[model samples]
Target: MPLPAMPIETDLLLAHLNGQRQHVLGILDGLDEDALRRPVLPSGWSCLGLVRHLTEDVERFWFRCVMGGEPTAIVALSQGTEAWQVDPDVPAAVVLDRYRQEIDRANAVLAGTPLDAPPAWWPPDQLGDWRLASAREVILHVITETACHAGHLDAVRELIDGRTWLVITT
Candidate 1:
């Protein structure tokens, strides 16, 4: 299915968001399963765990639950599962696939909805007084969050194998 057309600003935002998402994935490329699952920093978050967090918390929570008011997403958010923990039995491929799936779903929400549209649902109890009035605001917030995490992933990847996202060449 094709995504619906979006305004230019929305398109730009989505483009930036997608870039960061790819940056995150690119940082983890070529890592073995053990390296992906192994925590390299004091924060105790592995590359795979960060991908899971982006899938469940950032992509699913903001796009599905907040923008689309998806019932399953609402239930999942209400349960308050920690998104940063990947079960030992879960394969690395599964974690990566889920992130891709969530990105597709999130894009669907962004495509069909107008930037000015208010969120379909908001969890007052979950967020307390905080609020985002429109889809544009939500997109901006997600872009910032995803980009920040991509930077973190870059650092983690560096720690793992001295790989960096970018290298300045003269």
Candidate 2:
């Protein structure tokens, strides 16, 4: 896909960053609770779990880390000691909507901010007199974080069913 454009073309970095989100969207789109909550491999991570993790991650890293100047102390709720604590009572629909919306919000922030804009969360040195990153770096950060999750989601998706993202033509 050519990528969806806003009023401005933020450049290749943003496009690449958005691509990772698109990858995640592909993993999420058609899943229901049965498919989303199914376990994969050695860990207990599920499609829904992955979405939750990504949603929090996107907010912490993109919205907080970059835009709001906050920290990323929030860990994945499904990881390590907390793995077994996920509330089974939670509905998949709510989780999915929240995840999708957070991702869209992150995209909106990236689109609205200039690539060279200084994120409130950046280190003081980086945000110094001539601070602010090249638009490419911010997008690159988003891409790297999101792509790793996308990879994990892809595997989780495959484990849930037999689907591979590459297998679908559309």
Work out candidate 2's RMSD over C-alphas.
6.0
Candidate 2 TM-score versus the reference: 0.69
For model 1, residues 49-161, the per-residue Cα lDDT tens digits are 88988998889999998999884774244244367778999999899999999999999888889999999988768777899999999999999999999999888888888
Tell me each candidate's RMSD, in Å, in order: 1.9, 6.0
Candidate 2 regions with alpha-carbon error over 4 angstroms:
1-11, 70-86, 122-135, 168-170
Instruction: Give candidate 1's TM-score.
Output: 0.93
**Cα lDDT of all candidates, in order?**
0.87, 0.65
- What are the models' TM-scores? 0.93, 0.69
Which residue runs of candidate 1 sit more than 4 Å off their true CA positions?
Answer: 74-81
Could you tell me the lDDT of residue 36 within candidate 1? 92
Q: Candidate 1: how many backbone clashes?
A: 0
